[model samples]
Target: MTVRMTSARKAILEELESSKAHLTINQIHERLSGRLPSLNVSTVYRSLDFLSQNGLISISDMGVGTPVYEIMKEETHHHLVCSSCKQVIELENDLVAPFFEQIEKEKKTKVITNHLVVFGICLECKEY
Candidate 1:
């Protein structure tokens, strides 16, 4: 289905693309409210829902209180979160691809880890 692009959707997409960190719906609304004053929280939520459903964006809970959203891209990536300090580390696909390959071979099943976030203590926190 072709989703017609609206101003609200455009603003949200722009915000998601520009942001380095994933953001929650309220955070997105807050960022775009100044530029698109007519945009409301409900509109942001709905547009995000539509975009996420269309695979244009991704929504995930990265061991945080609220779920966050980011634009989906061709290159797959994963996150390693420090449970103690709440620090997030981005992991390249190459690093975990081999592990997933072994798992698939052993289990005889395809692994879907699009939103995988492995939680653990970082080195510094672990040493402390």
Candidate 2:
């Protein structure tokens, strides 16, 4: 599905691509407001939805109250979120591949999503 790349979409994609942290719609809008004075939250929302649907970006809850968006990369990765501290730890695909494979085999279905967020208490929180 090919969609026209509007200025809003391009700016949104660039913002996500440049950011290491997953951004919410408000964050993205706030960050881009300096450069894109005319950009609105609704446009950001729409662009994010379009980007997510087109596989350019990924939206994950990451144990946060609201969803966060990040640009998709060639090397897929997951997240282990600390439920207490809300610290996000990047989980490598190596650890997840076999688990996904097992699910695929057991369910006889394909696992299409490249990223997953597992919420748990971190070591610090557990020790405390």
Per-model tally of clashing residue pairs: 0, 0
Q: List the residue pairs that clash in candidate 2.
A: none
lDDT for model 2: 0.90
Full-model lDDT for every candidate = 0.86, 0.90
Q: By summed lDDT, which 10 consecutive residues of candidate 2 come out lowest?
A: 56-65
C-alpha RMSD for every candidate: 2.4, 1.6
What digit string (tens of lDDT, one per residue) describes model 1 on residues 20-90?
56899889999987898888888888999888887778888887788899987788788899989999999
Off by over 4 Å in 2: 1-3
